[model samples]
Target: MTVSDQTLSTAGTEVADGIVLTDVAASKVRSLLEQEGRTDLQLRVAVQPGGCSGLRYQLFFDERALDGDIVKKFGGVGVVVDRMSAPYLTGAVIDFTDTIEKQGFTIDNPNAQNSCACGDSFH
Candidate 1:
């Protein structure tokens, strides 16, 4: 999809294609990128094995894109997902939440059939 600057401007507070980034999540990522002084970094999300549920979620900052990767932009941030993990992450939303009991980024994935109690693993 074609994302304009205006679209990214509203991303922190709006949901698009069933995916979204909360203000806190966006801010945290932006801050880290600023500190690193790298404007090429992108948020990379993927699904891998080795969890209780047979699959685990992976999130990190990356600067490279592989062939066949699906790239998306939101709120001036780039999101990259490899072909192998795209099916599992489609329609998933990434957000940040700070609560008394927990604080961090979270993924709301509709494609998940089962998730482990720890909330880090899914299948």
Candidate 2:
């Protein structure tokens, strides 16, 4: 696994098979962490069995590392993926956008055969 300071979707680096964190997302995460005054926290990405598409993604700040967790660092941000969710999230690229239509994080998952219209769940 390699970490790069460059933005995602470029020839920068690949941290894992399917999980790529874009530069914008990393910067946003860092900004959020600074606002929260917590430097020990890491971004936890997980897949839960719910949502309209049968599986939903969970992203949050967590300080604890559970067993079988895969941790990858991009710049000053750390992305933690659980063992079970790795397969489902493999080849997924996470990005953040702030435009007039959308203003939040987005996930692009190649392993997903289908996703809901709400863009919150996938199968």
How much lDDT does each candidate structure score? 0.75, 0.83
CA shift of 27, model 2, Å = 0.4
lDDT string for model 2 (1-123, tens) is 232344344654345556888888889999999999999999999999999989999999999878888888776798888889999888898889899999999888888999999888998
TM-score of 2: 0.88
| Pairs clashing within candidate 1 | 8-75
Off by over 4 Å in 2: 1-14
lDDT of 1 at 22: 64
Candidate 1 lDDT over 1-123, as tens digits, reads 233333333634544444566666777788878999999898888889978999998989998878876666665677777878878876787887779998888998999998999998998
TM-score of each: 0.82, 0.88
Question: Which candidate's lDDT is highest?
Answer: 2
Runs with alpha carbons beyond 4 Å of true place in candidate 1 = 1-18
**What is the Cα-based lDDT of residue 89 in candidate 1?**
77
